[model samples]
Target: VRGTMRHLLVLALAAALLPVASVAAEESDVVVLTSQNFEHDTQASTGATTGDWFVKFYAPWCGHCKKLAPVWDELATELKGVVNVAKVDAEAHSSLRKRFRIRGYPTLIFFSQGKMYKYEEKRSLESLVAFAKGGYKDDTEAVDVPAPPDLIATLKGEFFGLLKTVLHYSKHPEAISQESAYFLAAGIVIGSVLASAFYLFLSLASPAPAKRVSQSKKGD
Candidate 1:
């Protein structure tokens, strides 16, 4: 009789706490998921399920992640029931981290229909919603994503990317064209000048390396 009473008491306690749990869920829009609950929450949203999920992979110590926290709160409030917003702490959950291949902190991914879409747009609420609409597609499809507003930055990035590729393949330094050689020399000169300036400043600020009289050798 006592064992049965104890079981009933446990059930009653769970029932009493249900309302509190529901109210808490109602209060917050974002779901804090760990490695434990990730598969269940995300997988259910696809097969036989009906919700779209937007999840953030973050590390707490990352400054970008810290700045993104409040934005996430706003995203949660705005997305609310329309889309399920969630976060996974990449540092704490190694499995999810590796599974998603999150190379940088504050990586955002949207999951729908057994496919995951990466969000590469600017980290803004509006941008995120736009991505939800059509910024991404399945892995096999070619997504012709437009460049961000800053065209100069985009072109510069492409230029540097091409430069790295060429440099990596060019076995001999002479493989570089004459024009490129001039530019490379200029870059090296500026870098060396800055490094030398820093080194001189540090040398001046540091304590004297050795007493001049040390040459006397303790007595003389």
Candidate 2:
């Protein structure tokens, strides 16, 4: 009876640890690709008999990348059967980084049938899974390239809207003076002028011949 009780106690202890071991094994199943394994794994993914391919380019030192780690892990687990989720450390993979022109950490790239798309914003696990499964539609339209009138018109519309709101709010029982309206108009004008000046400054600063030459040679 003593030996049997000891055996039962050992079995109970093993059973208690079984779940912990299972969780560890599940985590270990997430494929972590480094610079050394990137090419081989990506190639295998391309030739694989099943699933879409998704890769995240990240650097160990980036705070945002660190924050996104658990989200990526959850995405990996949730979409395990539907997608091949992998990660590449950008700092460790100079060639891959250059090839992809990865300007930032935590950039998620999706590939299907040899075509690729870059996810340029933060994404939730559900969204990521839906994207992998081709169930989500990106509703965001491409940004309209700013025309000179577009900015001026937008500023004008915003000023009018603000003026309307201010007038409406001022009609309350504790209404303030109309001077507040003038102040708001002045502020809007000042802000629009400043924004236009800043935009012009950036435009002028961007096309410098020397800067272009420097950038061209930096990669070499």
Candidate 3:
């Protein structure tokens, strides 16, 4: 009989703790965003899609960010099904940091209906949760989220592209080999000469506009 009572008490205790475990699981639902997938995921939230996002642009070592970590977790749990809570490590992802022009450590941005609303209020759990859950409508300051960067163009610019390479080598001559600098200069000169030759050829090839003449009739 004692063993049976013990089993019943253990089951009751486990039932009581199940909610705490569930809450812990919910808290971990905050999405971790990096530069690669940032635009794709955020762009999906625009224009009638249900996954509106509340994103925290934070540095991992920032003191204020560290302080708000738990509250941010709680906010995610509170607004789980209503709004998607996500975070980015700006210190690690320099591209996103530059893209958003994030100057501060912990910047909160809520994206909904193709607009971005910066959160400037106090970073309490209530404030964060409220802002995520349609409280952003009260604020008058909102801006359209910047368009997604073209992957191919971005890759080209980051690596070796014609114009970007020319500009870079022109501005910072010490960055490349001497042969590369000479080639860049030659490319610029050749491009200019070709453009001028094309203009001259077009001018000489096309006929001039015809002139209209009017004369009085002698019969008048």
Candidate 4:
């Protein structure tokens, strides 16, 4: 019983601290635009000579969006300071989704020369790189890419995934930081209580020795 309690406590603490790591996992140099900044970031003025803008609209909960996330992050890093590479959460900003005609969860849009261009190409590393660097013509689209089957899930397993989510939410910029802090504090308190209970349970544990007890009755 005490062993089981200890294990549970450890798991609880680990779960609580998971989100802290997920925030870093979710972060990248790629600019994540919210509803407030989507227009300012993507909308270019007439004759505006700013760098080309490559924006990928995604839904946070979309599996396709999840697969595209790392690739988009890489594209942003490679084209950093050369072209503007960013992402918008369509689910979070429904107005932008409707305005841009984002029918799908992972739509790619590029703005350049004071015009908006929809990218309908493959989302592979090479394809995205080429599209961003002006290798593709105005109308080029490819089949969508999907994650591999029989693949080892990211974060090694669900336990780690849960942990990452916890950490990510705890430090999420959009959500109140205090909420996460309080959550972590509560987790710690619960874990400590469980640990104490486990310790006391163990300290008070007294197993009767089968052979010794039987032999001791005769001695008595």
Candidate with the greatest lDDT versus the true structure: 3
Q: By the TM-score metric, which is better: model 1 or model 2? A: 1
lDDT of 2: 0.53
Q: Which whole-number lDDT from 0 to 100 does residue 122 have in model 1?
A: 88
Best by TM-score: 3
Rank all candidate structures by their TM-score, best first, as comma-separated numbers.
3, 4, 1, 2
lDDT of 3 by residue, 132-178 (tens): 77789895487877765555333322222223334444455454433
Worst window of 10 by summed lDDT in candidate 4: 147-156
lDDT of 4 by residue, 1-220 (tens): 6566566546656655443322223457787664445555655433435567788887555678878878888999899988888887565344456556689878887777656667776789888888878764546543222212121221122223233334445455354234234433443444345445545655576474476444456657
- TM-score of every model? 0.49, 0.47, 0.55, 0.51
lDDT (C-alpha, whole model) for all candidates: 0.56, 0.53, 0.62, 0.58
True-structure lDDT of candidate 4: 0.58
Cα RMSDs of all predictions? 25.9, 27.6, 25.4, 16.6
Overall local distance difference test of candidate 1: 0.56
Ranking of models by lDDT: 3, 4, 1, 2
Report RMSD for candidate 1.
25.9
* Stronger candidate by lDDT (2 vs 3): 3
TM-score of 2: 0.47
